[model samples]
Target: MRTLFFRSASPSPSNSPSRSTIPTSSPRHSFSDSLMEENIEMAQTLITKWDNSDVSSYTKLTSLFHDDRREAKEYLKCVRDLQSAMHHFVNSQDSSAEKLIISQNLMQSAMKRLEKEFYQILSENRENLDSETVSSRSSESRASTRSSVSDLESESEDELMVLDADQVSSIPMADLKSIADCMISAGYGKECVKIYKIIRKSIVDEGLYHLGVEKMSLSQVQKMDWNVLETKIKNWVNAVKVAVKTIFYGERLLCDHVFSSSDSIRESCFSEISKEAATTLFGFPELVAKCKKSPEKMFRTLDLYQAVADLWPEIESIFSFESTFAVRSLGVNSLIKLGEAVRGMLEDFESAIQKDQSKTPVPAGGIHPLTRYVMNYITFLTDYTEILADIFADYPLTLQTPLPEAYFGCYDVDESPISVRIAWLVLVLLCKLDGKAELYKDVALSYLFLANNLQYVVAKVRDSNLKYLLGDYWVGKHESKVQQYAGNYERMGWSKVYASLPENPTAEISSDQAKAYFKQFNAAFEEAYKKQSSWVVTDPKLRDELKVLVAKKVVPAYREFYEKHRVGLRRECGVDSLVRYAPENLNNYLSDLLYGASGGGSVSSSFSTTSSSHSRGR
Candidate 1:
């Protein structure tokens, strides 16, 4: 019934007052008739003016009347007075009822006109707000122009100030906050997010936000003032925090209601919300890249990430009402990405250092910087590994299906467990070190470099927490490699001594022949021994092993030949006899051949013999 009454109250042109309905004649020219005529004329005029006016002018006129309640009341009173006059005139005995009805129609038309004007003013106000909102969004400003009609009236002066300050493009924080709060209250959280993105872009465009320093060279970053850089980062972070907080406020209401009774539906809602939140907080990778560009920044960022990770569980607990899987996974993915990035940087650093080291001469008995750097980095990995495990503690550990081929040609799918990837990375560094060792011109030096570095690596691994990750088999394999390097060094140095010994000496071989062969052996041994003994074999155990290796090769062979030839050999030159030295003397010399001798010395220290023919006479 109420709906029908409102529908009937709306006036069409036919139902409205017309001049034809007014009487051609009246009984008296009374005051009521004159007053009614004047009120109707005023109402019609106002309606005509309102119809001719545009939305902006109408809005302004409406504001004026609305602000002054007494004036609005006076307009309403005139319409009522006309209605009362028409009713009294109709009841008079001589009055024309048609004239009274026309006056009543005029009063109704005026009331409808007022209602139409008020409705139009509201429509125009809404349209203007929409236009300004669209314009603000396009300009990428956090300052929104949309407001309630009351807010519009109150903030009009401030709006003028904003327009005057537009030339400066500095939006007041209060204004931004007001706009953001309005958006959040109206459930237009996405618009609130747009405000944040616009502000962020503005900051970036103004060169206030630093991103992706990884592309810059280390020298460039190093040249920057530390204090200035620190301030810049602090400002950037604070701005991000503020923007993120705004977005959070906008999302809080929606997030609270996202839960569903069905598990799958709830999960889907959670996924979407998380995706939105992640999009809002999407600058982590760039921040990580900036840290990667410098070691100091990298460590600092790592510490920051660790702090965040540590705080994550508490954050998750607080937001447990909302599904946290997506957010938790995001943090996990970030840590993994950072871990991989740090690994990559270390690999690159290792390669570069090795290349530099290879181009320089090996320092005598000193550890290479590359070695120290690698070991220290490995220690860092141990800590990082723990952090990763902690962050991913609830994560599924089911192994991913192995690819048909290994990822890098070095890592076998079956052997490459995720926990052991760091170990594999260390193995790669060691392999590179070995390749660098081969760059030495002297074969002995190459072997020595390998032995020293490999031994150091094995020792450090044995002593550090890396042992658990690499395992006993890995340790054993490297230890064997160290032994092999020592053996090779000894073989290459003693091959000349071995070559000097005749492969076969006949039973009838003459003393002169033996003398020539022995002379060759003495010269070869002296040359090799003198050169090699001064060479470094710093490890006591390796040095002793190498000495024993030389003795085993030279002493037995020389002793077998001397014992076989001694019966028929004539002692022509006593001290320089063909079979000059006893087996014990040869053994002693060979013991000190590589690492024990001070420098080049006599070829026969214990080989003196008398030049008497006593053996033949006897």
Candidate 2:
């Protein structure tokens, strides 16, 4: 550049106008014409020299940028010079047609070098240019790009670029930005963008692959064993989070910054790189949703639902561009399909509870298997409350009839649509349990079964997330029902024992009547204790409460009967045989009643009650 300008400025004897010929124009105009002629005639020295040599050797392509950043700056300058030459060839009248051809050729060579450099930088520094780091550090402008993971050795390589491969960073972000801007402004933006899309897209797809997200057809997912499918669902739950949080996020940051000169290019490149991977990533849950609906698959569906629902904001933000709308649509579509599957599963689950035809009553009047299964299932549903609340808002409960008025009573299902839906499911389970209680032969044992199952339901609601959704009103009401069931059990089971006593303990009867009454009491006590010894209460608190209740009713009445009549009877002969049970003996028998002895359906004589009929549950 200096040689061309200086030579044109120096005196040229032939062009000095010979001092004889009059000048046709001003001295300033004459000088400008001479300068333009010289530039047009000599040809650009820079583009010709690079065109004639091996660009890789002279530039040491990778090393030049990484080791000597000054060479990188010089390279951008050469791009600018070529652009200037092309602008002149297009606009200047005096420019030779051959110079325009040379500039075009030189521009292509420069663009090729930039493309290769861009690829190498992205490839070699994949980890360094990771999404987490890129998104976090990308907020800095070109002035501060050197301070990021790919820090610059020198900031002097123009505003957008300076490169060095060293400790923490491979090459500063500025280097890529500079190359992109140079090529874009030089009428080669399309080529730069194409190279960016290819390389960055591979990184995105590979990230998804490593994260275990795959594009699976419906048949492919359906053929998988449930255990295998569940594992994949869990992996996808983790993968979708990473893809949105860091992978797509970083790619978007890089794309926007590099191609910041053109909004259309940035949008188009990001969509091409990320949309497919993201669509596949999100489309997975919808596939899982299409699998055979079962009670077991409900939790998996909820997990998928939750994962997508959780990352939806980021998904929307990253895929907001019109070109990437399919990704957004797929994400939202997955959520919709997942919600539908869950609701369908809910209906099926309730029907299964209703149709349970198992005639075999739980032994010892313990908790029913259906009771545990339904409560456990609904309890898990509570963990998904916020999501389910939204889901149920759109699809309200669709039972043939509204919930029974007395079912929830004062509790308002309308407070939250999901709340009512869950409450309805639980009520359906309770109704099924009521029908199952009829299978028990003894009315007393049936009442005990209801008490045991209801106690379990109350505790489950009290202890878990159900307490919040169902509220204290529901729990308090159900708890009272449990107390009523236990009372009915006590009354029905012990009525005969109470009837054996006299209406008044102090009313004096004859000697023979007293002896007859004492014998009647002894036989009744033994028979009732033996019959009830196998009955069970699964909740410890409820079991203890029932014991205290029955004790209050039975012990006092019998104790008064014993004290009054036994004194007179003991005076006669054979008193020990007549009075078979003391008040202390009654207490021992009551302790042994619910805890079925090791021997099934049999009462141990010692009545220590060392074994339990049912395991205690919350």
Q: Against the hidden reference, what TM-scores do the models get?
A: 0.42, 0.86
* C-alpha lDDT score of every prediction, in listed order: 0.49, 0.74
Global Cα lDDT for candidate 2? 0.74
Residue-level lDDT for 178 in candidate 1: 32
Question: What range of 10 consecutive residues in model 1 has the weakest lDDT sum?
Answer: 602-611
Backbone clashes for every candidate come to 0, 0
User: For candidate 2, what is the TM-score?
Assistant: 0.86
Tens-digit lDDT string for candidate 1 (1-618) = 343222222344564557767534323445555555566566455434434233545554553233533343444455555555566566656475766666655554543444343343333433222212222332333234222222433444446345433221222222233333333332333433433433333332232223321133435544666445544444434543432333332233222222222344334433444444343343343345444343323343455356445555543542344455555555556566655555455445444443433345344322344555556556655666556455334442333643222222323222334344555456556766676676667787678667867777778788886766665667777788889888777777678778877786434577666666677777888787676555656566776777787888888887776776666565444634545678789767656643532222111111111001111211
What tens digits encode model 2's per-residue C-alpha lDDT throughout 67-164?
A: 55765676677778667657765776555577677667667877777776776666677787777667655343434555542334444446334333
Clashes of 2: 0
